[model samples]
Structure formats: C-alpha cells, structure tokens
Target chain A: MTSTPMTARRIRNGLKIPLMLAPALGLVVVLFGGGILVGLGQSLGYFPAIGLNEFTFSNYTTVLTDRNFLISLWLTFRIAAVTTVLSSVLAIAFTLVLREKFAGSKITTFLFQVPLPVPHLVAASGIILLITQSGLIARIATAVGLMDTPADFPALVFDKGGVAIILTFLWKEVPFVGLVILAILQSVGPQYEEQARTLGANARQRFRHVLLPLIMPGVMSTSIIIFAFTFANYEIPLLLGVRFPSTLPVVAFREYQDPDLALRPQAMAISIVLAVVAILLLIAYRRLARSAVK
Target chain B: MTAVSLRHISRRFGDHVAVRDLNLDIESGEMVAFLGPSGCGKTTTLRMITGLIEPSSGDILFDGESVLSTPTERRGAVMVFQKHLLFPTMNVAQNVGFGLKMARVSREETAERVKEILELVDLPGLEDRKAHELSGGQQQRVALARALIVRPKVLLLDEPLANLDANLRITMRHLIRSIQKEMGITAIFVTHDQEEAVMLADRVALMFDGVLQQVGAPDEFFRTPRTTGVARFFRNGNFLRGHRRGSTIHTDVGPIEIVSTSETVEDGPSVLTVRPEEVRLVNEETDQENVVPAVVTSLIYMGSHTQLTVTIGDTPWQIQAPAAFQARNGDTVRLLLPRGHVSIVADDDTATTGSAEATLAEGSAVL
Candidate 1:
C-alpha cells in the first residue's frame, strides 16, 4: 500500500522524457497529428464544410469494394517486396566485400555510398534518363550497332512490370542499408572473423553461420524502414508507374487532387488504409527479424 | 598428435622484423611455453603456426611436411585468443559445435562432442546460454572447448589467461594442462610472465628482441643459463668477475668455490652468478668453502623474507635472508654462496661491463 505513492526520484524520472519532449513535440503534434485528425474526421464522412455532417462508413466501404483497389494494393506490395529483397541482398553482399580490404576497396566503398545523400526524386529522374526506351542506354546501344535505332530498344520504362519504380527505390535504399550494416560491421571489429577462421570454418560456412547471424539484426531493422518508404513513397511511382495500376499512395494522391471535393473522403480512407498497412508491416517485420538469426 | 616445427622462420611488418630466425620443434603431445617480454615475437610465432600470418621467410612444418601453402582453416592448428573471441550471436552449444559442423559432421555427433567438451571444461548444462550471458572465465572455457571439439593437430594459445584475475588464472592453467595431456594434443602457449611459463610448460623458450634467447626445462634455466643476457633476465644479480679453475672462481677479493649443477666451463676468464635465494648468512665462528666476507649496505623487510644488499670487494650482491634475522646496515657478516646453485654463464652483451671495469683499472694505473 505504501508503494502506491511514487517517491520523488521516481516521479522525477517519469517526467524526464515528457519534459524534454515538450518543446519540440508542440509544433509536430499540431502540424502532423492535426492533419491526421482532420483526415480521420473526413474519412468517417464527417466533413461538415463539404455538406457531409453525418459520420458514416460508406467512404471506407467504397474504397474497400472498388475493383481497382486490389490491383493498386498488389502493385504497391510487389514493388515494395521486390525492391526490399533485391536491395537488402545486394547491400549485404556488397558490405561483406567491403569489410575485407582489398585493392581499390576504399574507392569502391566511396562509390557505393555516392547514392545515399541523393533524394528519391533525383534517383527517379536519373533512372528515367538512363533506362527509358529512347534514353541513354538505348542511344548507346544504337550507336554501338547492337540495335538499328533507339526505337528498336525494348520497352523498359512505363512497363506493366514497374521495373523503373523498383530500380529507383533500389538505387536510393541499397546504400542506406549498406551504410547501416557497414557501420555495424566496423564496430564489431575483425577478431570474430579471425576466431572463426581458427575454428576451421571455411569462407562460405563462416558467412552462413558466423557473419550472417551477427549482422542480421542490423540488416533487418534497416530493411524495415526501406520497406515502409518504398511502399508509401509517392514521387518515384508517380513518375515511373503506369496510370491504371499505380502504387496506393499515387492513387490516393490522385483522388485527393480531384476537383470534385466529394472524392476527398475516399482519398482520406485510402490514406488511413495505407497507415494501417504500414503498422501491420512493422509488426510483421519485427516478428520475422527476431527469428531470422535462430 | 602433431609435431609442429618452425625452421628459420621470420616475419616482418614493413621494415620492422617481428620474429627473426625463429627455430623451434614442439614434439607431438608436448606443451611448450613461448616466454618473453611484450613485443618479443612470441605471439607472432604462434600466429604463424596457425597460418593466420604468413612468415615472410622460411617454412613451418607439421609432421615434417611444409604447411606454408595451406590456408588457416585447413591447417588444423587452432588458436585460442586472449579475449576468448566466441561468436557474439551464438549460444554456447552453437559456438562449441561450429567447427564440427564445418567438417560436415552429423548433427548428433556434433552435439555429443560439444556436450563432452563442455563437461571437460567444467561448465556442464550451459548449452543454451548466449555468449554475452556467460562470465569471463566461463567464456574462456567455452573457447577452449570449441577448439578441442575439432581435435586440432596443434593448439595455440596467445596469452589466453592474460585477461583473468589471479585466482581464475591459476585454475585455468591447471585446466589447460590437464586437457592438453588428456587429449594428447601438441600445444604452444605464449606469455610474458616467467612464473606461468615455468609452471605450465614442459620446456620454456625465452625470447628477447625478436630472438629465441634460450630453450630448456624450467629448472635448467635456473641451473645453467647460457649467457649473461639469460642470467640477467632471471634476476641473477651476484656476478663475480674471475678466472675459472675447476669449481673455483677467483674474483678480486678471493677465490670463491662453487659447485655448478649442469656443466663445467673451460678454464678461462669467467663471469659466474648464484641465485639470490641460495645465499645464506653465517657467524664469524663458522668457516665454509664458499663463504665470502660481506657487509650489509641495505635491507628491506618483505613479509616472506628480508631482502639484503651486501657488498663484497666493491661489487653489490642481492640476498634474500630469513625475515626474522637480526641484520642491519653497516653490519659485517660472512655470506655463503652455496654449491649447486651458482652457474657459470657465457659473455655476450654484458661483457662490456668487464671492459668498463678495465678502463677503471687503467685510470688507477695512470694515478
């Protein structure tokens, strides 16, 4: 019974974070949370300014039941999954090579990190200029006599496969994953690898049993952020994806920008749905990541 | 069992020679200690045996075959590091069984061997604990078990007991020696402390400035050290400059009689020393063959013994006397330098002391 009242020191410890967070959290709550509240209110069909004062479930039902919703969801999921798997795998492989110093290793590490600071928009633009049918690679092929003309080059950009979108995301996110894991590898030092060598683990076995399990935690956590970003990011998919089956963010964004304001609730519903999916993904990734080493 | 040998092997890091002309043969199933001060190439020699660091010159042989071209994993010369570098992400059983798994042993066999080795190291039923969860001593046992599971041809230890506290270090030393003997595995341990070297090794190889100064049984080092450098390293402080004639060394003061336990030197100019612990105090009424008249200049009353500094014919000598003895500064006493404890060592870097003394003699002649 006496433990019910916290001691002064305990009370001080409890208030430490909130007191520290109070200053920066004020503007963030108003600008970020305020917008989410407005979006939620509208998604529930309670936009009084639009002459819809009654709270209802019609907007959610409409967004859920729409036939193209599934296609948009599939496109978003495919792009995010493919980009994440490829980039995470490539980052780990490249980081392993970088960790073992060789000729030109420093230069290779410097070039691998060159894409890290470039924004997603810039990456998307670069991929467009270099990979589109009449873009730089196509012209180079034509000039090199591999193709008769630039138009003869295969259709790469604006394809139904969403290759351009995945490429752009990979370009931006692979370096992020690599940088995080590389920093982790540096902190871990070289003695563990030397110890493994002395234990008679060959190169492949060392990587599989020792190095992989050690660096898995860093890779998995960074890859979660990569998945979320690639899933809901708007610009890369908007510029690279086809119009009919674009990622969910682009579709929701398109609906939000429509001149007819009644579609606002549908757009807000899609936004809420996207947030819910991201949360589910966060939970799913943590579960998988925790068991990966074992 | 593997008879590991290094033949004229040397390692250089850029221009600095880490190990120069290191030649040693470790017999199969025998344990040898590589003893040296820090930076004396002992660790470098151990790493070379594991093939972790390539020797810049010469060859390393296992069972009389050159293993210079073999990679570390295939060499079967496993090493236990000072930090006991167990894999951080692995549990105890996983870490211990990793080597067996690499050899493509079945899961059941690996498990059985891991269990056996863990019990041997006295950490039973700790299979599921993570590496970080173990205490420092427990981690070292896991490391030893991990190396032993593979049945390495030669086991190398690079100061593995260096990180432990005093009590734990003694326990680990006994555990290591028993395990090595039980497995009949050839082993080499590198350490800077002479006591540990003498305690653990069947034969101790002393190194100095990237060279093996001497190699012998621990007792032989105390009885018959080869050179002044070796004698000075063992703290043999009472060097008498004399001419050798049988067991007698005629110094400036008088002919001091000694009985060397190992070898008799050729009749020539000699420099001899005895262990400080072998020197004893006697009264004026006693007469002895090796007795030399001395005066106590200083004394320090350590708990176990009183350390006394005495001078005989202008040369200071250190002696460890019984702690309860009544001796004071300026007391004239007769000290006995016992037979079978004094050794005649060869002249090397410390022979310059004789030349410096000759210059003093020359100055006295000029005066």
Candidate 2:
C-alpha cells in the first residue's frame, strides 16, 4: 500500500527537481531548525543531562530582570544604533563625493576599500594602537610637545562609552555600505540625474529627490546586516569594552563559561533573546524595504 | 525673430573636438532637426543648447540675451532623452509635475497642468502608474509630457524616438509634431535618421565630422545637397566623377545635361549626383538630349516601385520606375538623366575627390 502511494505521488510530481534539491534543503533544516529548537528548549529550563527536565518561565524572568543583564542589553542597543547611523550617513556622503571622477579618484577609491578585506579584529586592534593613550597618535602628540605625555591624550579606547568599538565599526562597515550603494548608483547610471536637471531640479533637489530614493533599498539592507553583526559581535566589544557594563554577547559568553552548570539555561535564555531581537529587526527591515520600493 | 542663436559654438574634450564651430539661428516657433550619424555632434549640439554642456568656446543666446552662464535648471530649455529616464521611484503624475514643483508652482496649479499635459499625450488616467509599469511608448510619452509641462521656452529632443518600435515611432512622430505646433514652442530635434529629419522638421541641418554641412528645407536637401559629404550622408543620390563643359557634364556612362548652381564651373574635376527616382527609363528610340543607350542588367521588385539596374558602356545606373514597368536582363533600354535633377558637387577636398575618382575607375556605381 505504501509503495502504491509513493508511485502515485512520484507520477504526479516528478523526481528530478526534488532529488536535486534534497541535500541542501535537508542540511539547512537539520542544522538551522535543529539548532533553534535546542536553544528554545534549553531557554525554557529543560536540560536532561544535568537532571533538570522541568520546563519553566523562571529562566526568562530572572534573565530579563537582572540589573547587569538589563544594562548590557541597553549598552548593546546603543552601540549598534550609533554605529549604524554614523556609518550609513558618512558612507552616503563619501559615495556622493566619490561618484564624480577627478584627479586621484582611483587612488582614493583604492584606499577606501582597503579596510574592507581586513578582519574586524585587526581593525579594532589598529584603532586601539592609533587612538589609545599610549598609542601612536598619543606618542606623536607628546613628541611634538602638544601634550606633555601620552597620558595627557584624551581617552578613546576601553572607555565606558564604547567609543573605540563604535569607531572600529565605522572604519570597517562604512566602505562595505558605500561600495554596495556605489554599485547601485553605477548600474542606475547618471542619466536620471541629467533628466532631473533638465526638468529644473537643482543639485540638492536632484540628490534628495532622485539619487536618495534609488539607493535606499541597498542602503537599508546593508544597514540591517551591519546592525545585526555589531549587535551580536563578540570580539570588538570584548577587546575594547569597559568592565562596568559589557555588551549582551559578552555577558552571555561569561554565563556560558560559568563552572555552575545550572547557569546554562540563563545563558541560553540570553542567546534566545538576542536571536529574537535579530529576527524582529529582519522583519522590520523587510517591511521597510517593501514600503520603500512601493 | 530668432528664438535661439548658436554663434560659433564649439566643444572639445581634452584633445578631441566633439562639435566644431557651429552657427545656427533658429526662428521662433520653428522646428529644426540636427541630422547626422552617430558621433556627428548632433547630441552635443542639443546638450549645448539646453545648457547641459558648456561649449569650450562661443556663446548661445536666447532671444539676443546671452545664456552662457545660466545653469541648466534656470535655462528654461528642457530636453527629452533618447532613453526614457523616468524616475523609477515616482509615478507618472509625480514625474510629470516634478519640474513645476521645482519652479515653485502651486500644488493645485501643478496638478491641473500635469493632468492637462497627460491628456495631451493621450495618457489620461495613468497618473498613479509607476514608471517601470509603463510600456516603452508610454514611458516615452511620460517623458515628453514631463518636458512639456514645464512650458519651457525651447524644447530639445535628443533622438527621442530612436528607442521606439517602427509603428510606434511613426505615431509618436505625428503626435510630437502636432503638440509642438499646437504649443508653438521653438523645438530642436536631433536624429541620425535622414527620413525622420526630413519628415518632422521645418528645416534639416545635416552634420558630418562635427561640422554643419548644410541647413535648408527638407526638399532643398533632397534637391541639392551642398557638398559631397552631405550627398554621401543622405545616401539618396548616386555619385560619379564628371567634368563640367558649359551646361553639360561628361561621364563614363555618357554625356549628361546639368544645371550648375555655381556661376562658373572650374576646370578641375567635379562630382555628379542624381537621385535614383529622377533617372528616367524611356523607349529605346526616344529622342532626349541627355539620353544614354543601355542594357538591362538586373531588376528588383519593390512594393511601390521596381528598381532597375542598367549598364551604359562600363557604368551602371539605378533607375526607379512603376512596379508594372517590367523588363528582363539583357533587354536594351534608354535612360534619361534629367537636367534639373542632376547636382554637380565641386570637389573641394582630396578625400572626397579621391573617393569619387576611385569609384569611376572601378567601372561600377554604388547604389
């Protein structure tokens, strides 16, 4: 009876397409779906390995109300928001200026894209070495007598404000976003701007009304990726953040590494919350992009 | 009154000259076409007029007022691009009303005029449609409407119909001509199509190699192209090497009577040109002053007319006759080169003169 049904379905829907896509689909569902399910299960306080199998909302309640956890969440949001906004605005302005061909434009473009291939950790360290109190800039300033010593330089790295983390993000992500927007601009061509000019739009009006809307979708998508990466990123904030209030990812890492195994549920709960926030942001981005295109 | 005058306008990019010293005076409410091949400076000239491009040297005047320093947005001369550059983010109504909004026209007045122009372009009730949703012809109509809604003093079209299909091109040609006439706006159309230039413009200015070869009425261009370059560009006449002797010219085909536009034909070689349709085929025994005896070489049946190739001595001539006038190869015939229809272009440059002499030496004619 099973053989007959299988044969009938095979006749109705051919085997070639399904057979070709089965491996990729199976791997994706097994890895992604299975991982999410385990995380969700653990977040609800279900852990059979350590003999605690009861599901409860206690883990979520405790994690959500903790003072340190709340501060970490807020700090993460602030860093990501500031970094995304600054990067997008500066990238757009840079792209606009770079769109015009001029002397040394090729060299400028090459230098702008150089940071893109470098790892985020490398960029974070580079920023530390240049802007820290005893770093290169401070040493140079002290040598030039602008400051009496390296300690006289203002604080930029490892501060409570996460200034170095944000600066590192700006240095790295600005070019990534700018390059995407530039590709769109080049593909869309300059004819539209010329047409707008003939239709009596001034330079500012043309940029606002013509160029901005055309590049918005690319900008929005890249911005969402940047926001999610920075929000959940571990290394940059780990290397540059202060001890008072760390990013959510750093707090989660500390919880996961705790010697007390009962803290596993709390760590999983924090990870689950971070994943939820990311999913919500992705949904919002999709809606925003749809409305923008329409 | 001249609406726009381009006095000795020239544009160069680094070392390459795009447009030479072009002088043209466009009368008020008259439509003039800059006709040329690609890279012949037609578009460059249009851009200069619209102030999108500044000439390397010389000035453009609008009604005797120099507009060399005026920005493109304030020049009051709008252009419809060859490719429909409709803003993909905007709907038809917004695109058409963009200029008015920029000019600070009241919202109510802008909407009213946008509606009026859309109706004029036969695109009513399409105000809400995105530019990407419109068809090619409809997009072009929106572009035209956008340019026209501004009420510009001079309208420029940079090969606007070059992207449309053949049937739509004809319809658009008629529509654009009608709209321009109804508005009485001074317009300049740039096109590479000779037929389009002749059919649509009050006067056709032919360009070759960044220079204006001739500017005259459509029929004037067909009747008498000023130089060998103009004749060659139009592709409507057959060029042959000839020597003018009084009121007649001697060619390899035979002696042909001609009407010389020049006061006196120089003793140097000349280029003779005649339209294919003007080369008449007559009875073998007909007594015509410029008649030549020849044999039918080949015949092509065109829809409206039949094209016949006849050989006289060692030269071949193309003659167009009614499709019903049929003859097979090897049949003897008589051809007449009408005196009034023949044009004698003086060989002014070595390039044209060398090519003309080469064609005569080859013992075959180019159609």
Candidate 3:
C-alpha cells in the first residue's frame, strides 16, 4: 500500500501506446470513424436527413447491379493496374541508370526530381495542353503538315480509355517512386554488385540476382502507395475524363450533386464501395510488403 | 597454379596517382601481402589485380597471358572486400552458392559444395541464418566461403580481417592462411597491419606514397632494412645522424667501427641504425672498442623484457634487455653497439624532420 502498487501501476500504464496517443488518435477516430459510419448508414438507406430512416441494402443492390457503375468500376481498376505497373517499371529503370555518379549527374537528378514537388492537378493540365486534341501537339502537327485539322489528331484526353489520366499519373508518380528506389540503392551501395561481379556474375545477372532483390521492398511499398493514391484520386480523372463511363470518384460526385435529394444515398453507396476497395488494397499491400522483407 | 604478373602498372585519379609504375611477379601458389599504411595504394593495387580498376598504364598478366581486356567476371580472380558485403536477402547457404548458381551449376552439386565450404570455414549448421542474424566474424566467414566457391585462380583479400576484434583477427589470420594453402591458390593480401602481413604472407611488400619501399621475407625485413624509411617503419632501433670515415662512423655518440655491407655506402652523410635488442648493456668503467659510457634515463618493465632509455653525450638510445636485468634511473652503464647490428642506411632527406623524430619517440615508447 505504500509505494509499490503506485510504481507498478505507473510502469504498467507506460506500455499502453493507445492511451498515450489518445489526443491525436481520439481526433482521428472521431472525425474519420464518424464520417465512415455516416457514409455506411446512408449507403444502407438509413439517412434521416432526407426522412428515409429504414435500414435496407437496396441502395447497395442498386449500385452493384447498374451497368454504368460496373463499367466505371472496371475502368477504375484498369487504370490503377496499368498505371501502377508501367510507372513502377519505368521508375526502377530510371533509378538504376541514374544511380551512377557521372558528370552532370547532380543536374540530371535535379531534373528528374523536379516533377515531384509539382501538384497532380498542375501535371494533369500540362499533359492535356501538350497531348489533347486541338492542344499543342495537334497544332504543331497541323503546322508541320502531318494533320489537316485539330480533329484529325487522335483522342488522348477526355476519352473513355483514360489515356491522359494515365499519362498524368505516370508523370507525377514515376519520379516519386524512382527517388524512393534510388535512396535504397544508394544506402545498399555498389559493394554487393562488385562482390557479385567478382563471383563471376555478369551485368544482367548482377542486376537480376543482387540489385533487384535488394530494392524490391522499397519498390513494392512505393507502388502500393501510388496505386492507392491513383485509384482514389478525383482531380486528375475529373479534369480529363469522358461523361459516359467515368471513374468511381467522378460518378460518386455526380450523384451527390444531383438535384434529387433522395439519390444522396446512392452517392454514399458508391463512396462506401470505393473505400472498401481501397481498404482491401491496403491489406493486400501490407501482406506483400511483409513477404518482400523476408 | 597460375602466376600473376603486374608489369609497370600505374593508376592515377585525376592528378593524384594512387600507384606508380609498380612491377611485381607473384609466384604460383605463393601468398604475398601488400603491407602499407592507409592511403599507400595497396588496396588500389589489389583492385587492379581483381579487375575492379584498370591500370592507367601497362598491363596485368595471368599465367603469362594479358588480362587487360578481360571482364571482371571472366578474370578468374575473386576478392573478399574489407567490409563484409554479404547478401542481406539470402541465407548463408544461398549466399555461398550464388557464384555457383551464376555458373549454372546443378542444384544438388551446389548444395553439396555449399555445405562442404561452410564446414571448411567452421560455420557449419548456419546455412539457414540470414546475414543480419549472424555476428561480424560469422558474416566474414560467409563472404570467404562465397568467394572461394567459385574456385578462382587468384584470390585478392582487401583488409579482410580488419573489422574483427583482435582475438578474432588472429584466429581468422590462421584460418585464411591455412585455407589458401589447402586450396593452393595464388593470393594477394592487402593490409595496413604489419603484424598480420608478417604472420600470414610468404613475403611482405611494403609500400609508401604510391611506391614499393621494400619486399622481402619477414625475418629479412626486420634484420636488414634497405633504407631509413624501412628502418623507421619497423621501429628497429635508434637512427642517429652520422658521417662515414673509413670503417668507422663519427656521430654525437662515440665513434663505433662499422662493416659496410651495402655497395651504395659512399662515406658521406650516412645514418647508423641498430636494433634495441642488439645493444648490449655491460658493466660500468669497461673500455670496449664499440662501448660508450651512458646513464640510464628510464626503465620500462615489460612482461618478458625490460626497455631502457639511456643517454650518451646528450643523445637518447633504446636498449631491450631481459626483465631480470637491474638498472635504476640516473645509474651509470656501459653500452656496446656490435659491428653486425649497426646498419648504415642511406640518409633520406624526408626522414630528417621533427615530426619523424616524434614518430620514432612514439614507436620506442610502444616497444
């Protein structure tokens, strides 16, 4: 009763990180948890603000079965997958080439990283201006006699294929992923490569067996972040997307802005589905990252 | 058995030359050590031999054939780096079998050879452990096994044991020497540690400032050094400034007759060097031919031997005697410099500085 129990309780209390993080964690739980709960309730058709207070799965059923929503979901998945794979491949290639300390390497590295600080919205606009029909390339092509008119140029932006969105994501994400991989490569250094060469490994063999395995974890983690970010991004897709089959976030926004207040639950339903997909992706990413470390 | 020959090899980075016009022939199955202090170009020479760095001029030949245009993987020479650069992602067995896999060896034979090499390095049953899970010494053994599994014709070791503790360093020195002998590979060991070089190599090549200072057997190096630099490097004895007159050299200390064995000794501005163990302490008032009267300045009691600093005509001289020899500070003693122990080295202009004198003082203090 003297001092032992007080000291013991204090030491035991020190082990609770959640208790220590109550201030910030509590705010996150309230804001994010409350927002997610509201969305789930609305997605389940329980929004009392519009006087619909019944707990039903009809909204989810409707959204899941819609042909337009299905197409939008497929487009989102395709864009995320293709963008993640292509950007990561290009990033790893650029990182390997720029790892060496050659003349003007400092300037070259600076140039490579220049796009990182730029906003995705700005990069999307830049891509549209350069490659969109009736944009800079079309004008230049017509002036060079390669095209008769701006309409003769191929459709690169505001198309169902999402080519401009993919290009914008690549422009922004490749350097970000490349910088991360470059950091890991620099930390591991050239010693292992040299050792592998001395052990009779050729150039390709060294890259495959030595450098690739060493940088896999960094590459995977960065790719996961890029995938999640691009999948959830609303700005790039909204700025350079067609009207027929839009990305999930764009469709969710359009439903939320509909004049019929009764359709708000449909917007929340789409939002909930997108969040679920992102969470599933996050779980998969964590599993892949843990295995890569091993 | 392959002899490695470096013919007039020189390496320069910009205006700074790392190794200058070095010509060395390493006999087949011989383990030669490149011994020098840091920044003395030993590692550069080793890397050049391993084909990691090409020479700025001249060429390297393996078994009398030029390997100048050969790639590093095809050079048939492997190097153990200073730091243990074991593959972090692979376990011990996988790391050791990497080179074998590169050569497309069968999995069964690779596993068998990996096990055999792990046992040879005394790291048996550790094949499943990752590099970070093992200790420094164990990681080094894995690196050694990895390099040796390739069956390279020449082995280049760059300060392989420098990261280990003193006891482990000694143990690994014997392990490397025995393994090299057992494999019968021509080896080049580059190290800044003189003791390690002398303990392991068949011959030690001492270097300084991009040049080979001396190369000989360990015992020959200690008994007879060719220059003042080598004498100072070995910390053999007191180097006193002297001038030759006939068979005797006149110095601050009394003139001691010397027998000139070097053809380059020409009777002007020579330095006399004698080992501390060679200087004999005799009874006072003895008038020997090469004996001089001195007073003991200090005595250091080492475990097996006692070191004495004695002064004769204001110049300090060091002498090593048995621990039982009794002498106190300020005691009068007679010292003899035998003609065989007194080596007259060519007086280099670089060795006559206050900093050099300070280094000699520090060296004698350690002795």
Candidate 4:
C-alpha cells in the first residue's frame, strides 16, 4: 500500500517553491525588516522594557541640536565627497593605464586587488602609522635632514581638516573601485573601441565616447557605495580622528556608550538619520543609472 | 600599379610568425575578401591595410603613396567591425556625425552629411534611435553609415556579417555588395565563410596557415584551387591520395588530368581534390569511363538540393543532386569525379595527416 496520500502529494508540490524561497525571505525579514522596525521604535522613545514608554520628539530634537551634530555631519559629507571624487578619477586612470598589454600589467592588477582583501581597520592603522608625526614618514624626514626632529612633522594626521582620514579612505577604497571598473572594462568587449578608431576617434575621443560611457555604471555605483561606507564608518575616524567634533558615526558611538540609558534612543535616532541619508543617495544613484542607460 | 598593395609584408608576434612575406595588390574599386580560418593572418592583413597594425617588414601603399608609416587616423580608411560598434550613448545620427566632427567639420555640414548618410543606409528617421535600441540589422546599418560618412579612400570590413543571424547575414551580404559596388570605393572584406566571400567579393584571396594560398576570382578558386588547403576550405571536397604519372594523377576514384608549371620535381606521391558538385551520379549500369561504383549511405534534403553521402571503396564522397532527383538510402549508384578540373597538389605526409583526419570526422563524416 502507498503511504503517500493524493492530497498530501498535491500539497507538497504546491509548497515546493515557497519552501525553497523560505531561507531568503527569512533573512530579509530578520536582518533588514527587523532592524528597520527596531530602529523606528527606538527613535520614537517607545521601548517599554527599559521603562521609557512615552511618545515624544525629544530624541530627534536632541540629535538635531546636539553641539557637534552639524559639524560632524558636514565633516562626514566633505570627507566622503572628496574621497569619492579623488578615488573615481584615480581608479579610471589606473584602469586605462593597465588596460593595454604590458610587462607589469598582471602585477599591477594583483597589487591593486591586494588592498581589497585587507581589513579596513588594518589598512587604517597602517596608514596612520606611516603618516603620523612620530611615525615612519617623520622618522625618514628627520633622518634625511629634511626636518630637525620628528616632532616637527606637519600636523596632517588627526587634524580638523580630516585630511588623514580622507587619505586613509582613498588608500583602501580606490583599489576596490579599480577592480570593479576593471571587470566592467574587460566585459565591454574591444570591438567598440576598434570601431571607434576606424570611425576616426583618437585615443581621447575613444575614451570619452566609447569606453567611459560603457563603464559609467560601474564607476557611479561603486562611487556611491564607497561614499556611504566612508561617511558612516566609525573605527577609522575614531582612531585617527581629531579631538573636536568627529564624524556622525563617532558621535553616535559616544552616545551609545554613555552610562545614561535614556540617551540610547538619541543615538538610535542619529543612526536612523544616517540610514535615511544613505537611502536617499541610493535612490538618486538609481535614477542617475536609469538615465545613463537610456 | 594598384589601389592597395602590400609588398613582402611580414608580422611576427614575439617568436611566432603571423604573416610571412605576403604580397598582394588590389585594384581601385575592387572588392576583395581576405578569406581564411581564425588565426590564418587574414585579420592581421586587414589590420595592416587599415593602419591599425604595423607590419614587421613591408611597404603598404595606397594610390602609390606609402601608408605603412601613417597613423590609423590619417590613413583615410574606415573599418566596419564584425560586431556593430555604434556608440551606445549617442543616437544613430550623432554616431554618423562623429567622424565628421573629428575632422573639425562645421556643424551645418556635419548635420547635412549625417542626413545624407542616413538616407544612404535606408535609415532616414532612425537618426534619433540609440544604437542599443535598434535591431541587429539596423545597428549594423548605423555602423556602416558611421564608417561611410567619412568618405574614406577605402573601406575595410572585418567579418561584418559574422554577428547576424543566417537570414540577416544573407540579406546583409547582398546589401553590402550592392553598396560597395555603388560607391566605387576600394573595399576589403574579411571572413572565414567561403560562401560569404564567394557571394560578396569580386576577388577572393584564399589564405591558409598564415600564407596566401591563392588569389583569384571566385570561379577560379572554386574550379581550380591552387592548393589542397584552399579546396578543403571551400566545401565538401573529396581528397584522394594519388601518384603522378606524367600529366595524369592516378587515385582511388580514377586518374585525374592536370597541368603543372614546376617541372623540376618528380611527383611520386600527390593528392587530388574534387568538389562535390563536380561529382556526378549516374545509373549503376551506365559504364561511364570516369565513374566509380558506390552505394548511397544517407540522403539529406536541404531546401534547394539533396545531399547524398555515397561510399566508394571504403571512402565516402558527398554528391549533390537536384531536389527532385530519385535517390534514397542504400541505393547503389555510380559516382563520377570530374577529371579535367580536379586539383592536384603534392601531399605533405606529416602536416596533412592530422588535419585530414580531423576534417574527415567533422559533422559530415561517413563510416
């Protein structure tokens, strides 16, 4: 006798597709949807377990009027913007130089990809150690008679300008952009470039007309992602950042670590603001991408 | 003495020789195809002609002036690639105007020329459509328009129809031939498809193993191929090992009559190549003098004609017959190998054994 019933068989076949998709759906809900809900509830100051159960706008107001909020936000935007622009230009140059066949192309490509696998914190520390006043650069300067002492090294690291932080981001981020754009460049297929040459486009014209537009999507998307990552990053800025108002993520971390439990919602509200900025940037990027494709 | 001439052209990629001591002269207003397999230096030859590649040692002259030293941009030659290379960001009109713009042509003239070229390509209103938005054939038309708008001295096409579907390819072949003929511009077409070369080119330059096997009219190359490689590349040709006795070459099929210019070498072992269409099928009892007995192993009906695989003395020869011909599998028939036009070349025992075995086992192999 068959142990499987007709109804059960029909039900099993009907549930097969949903069963296969269960893991992905569960991941989206638990990770993304759940995080958003938790952030929203905490931002509103309505968490019951911690005994703060009131509907108020104080968290948002505090986050907005905080002493370092505006400066940190501006600082973060400036650093991210500079890093994206500089890295995108450098990545495009690097890709063009390495696109053709040469003796060192493979080694150059390998070296560019090496930074991508390195942890961001590790890279940050490496940059700090190399560029700090008491670090190897200053030591070399002093030894080479360029400076009288290591303490006389210029105050680039941990300055109000955030030059050191931007440099650190560029050092680690440019290679990622290069690798992504390199793959895009390779997939573009050289037929178009050859046709352009035949159509009387010189090297510059070919780059502007054929190769650049084809690779623009990869460049823009990678640039936006890098901008968001550098802007929201906490550890690198916290370690190598100046004593004054740090980035938004650093400010949020300080609030989160404070002993007073009531300030946790304020930090969560700041995080929610950062998340909104990121989502807005993403939406703008998608719109730009659609326009470019058309 | 010619519109395009390559004298003793040679290209070496590191240690490997791509094209060695190649010499060719194409007349003005002639459409010639550099026909060969993938790596046989046909593309390298075209690239040299278009000034995209520099020959290792040679002088390439167009209209009695050396273009070998000229850069690609100043050579006054435009190339249409196998894949449509229309600018993705620009509409068809902008792409067609790109070359004129590069030459610093005025905006009014560029616009007028772009319109004229779009009309020439039969794509008048398609000027506003982006390259990707157009169909494959339409994109190819744009590519052609973009190249021809420059009004170059010559047009070089690198397998321009290789990317299209079968029907589109056939249609484009006729279109390109008509356009090339109409424009009276020196055209160089590169392709590995023999049929395409035969259909499009006024003269076909058959290349094999990085050397020019023969350069002649399509009928000459088809009827009197200078080498076994050329005959093999053309179609389903039956090649039989033979021995030369005076002016005749005796083979398994029969003795083939031939003429040779080189009389210094004594021919002991040779090969005879005959195309399938030259192989006639007659009644088994008809005792034609040049006929060989064979049995039909398979019959394939291909719209215009029927292709028969007939086995004769352990070797299967392809015989093309009319579509309405009465023929079926397992029918005994007598096959005739043409004696007068059959090609005979000295067989290099080492080189051909491998390629012949490989070519024999290719899709139409018979047991």
Kept native contacts, fraction for each prediction? 0.86, 0.84, 0.91, 0.73
Expressed as tens digits, the lDDT of each residue in A1-294 for candidate 3 is 779999998888886776789999899999999998998998998988889989999999999999989999999988998999999899999988798889988899899999999999899989988998879999999999999998899998999899999999999999999999989988888999999999999999999999999888888888888889888889989999898689999999889999998888999999999989888977987897788666
The estimated TM-scores of all candidates read 0.92, 0.93, 0.94, 0.81
Candidate 3 lDDT by residue in tens digits, B238-346 = 7776557778877656688887665655665557778888999877667777887788999999989999898777768788988998978998888888887788765
With candidate 4 superimposed using the best TM-score fit, by how many Å does residue B169's alpha carbon deviate from the native? 2.4
Candidate 3 DockQ score?
A: 0.87
Candidate 4 C-alpha lDDT tens digits along B1-367: 1399889999999998899889988999999999999999999988888888899998999988898777887788899887777777788888889898878899999999989888887888777887789999988888898888898788999999988899988888887888788889899989999889998998999887678889999988777776666776777456666566777766666766665546554655666767888778777577556676777898888879888887876776787887877766887887766666566654434365777645543422231
For model 2 the interface RMSD, in Å, equals 0.7
Looking at model 2, give its docking quality level. Answer: high
Cα lDDT tens digits for candidate 4, A197-256? 877788888887778888888888898889889878988889888978688899888988
Q: After superposition, how far is residue A124 of candidate 4 from its true place, in Å?
A: 2.1
lDDT of 2 by residue, A1-294 (tens): 789998988876797788889999999999999987887888898889888889999999999999888889889989998998899999999999888899999899889899999999999889999999999999999999999999999898989899999999999999999999889999999899889998899999999899999998898889899999999999999999897799999988888899998998899999999889877877886797788766
Which 10 consecutive residues of model 1 chain A have the lowest summed lDDT?
A1-10
Interface Cα RMSD for all candidates?
0.9, 0.7, 0.6, 1.3
How far does residue A221 in candidate 4 sit from its true spot (Å)?
A: 1.0
DockQ of all models, two decimals each: 0.75, 0.81, 0.87, 0.52
Q: Evaluate residue B63 in candidate 2 and report its C-alpha lDDT on the 0 to 100 scale.
A: 97
User: What residue runs in model 2 are displaced by over 4 Å at the alpha carbon?
Assistant: A1-19, A285-294, B250-255, B260-268, B328-332, B352-367
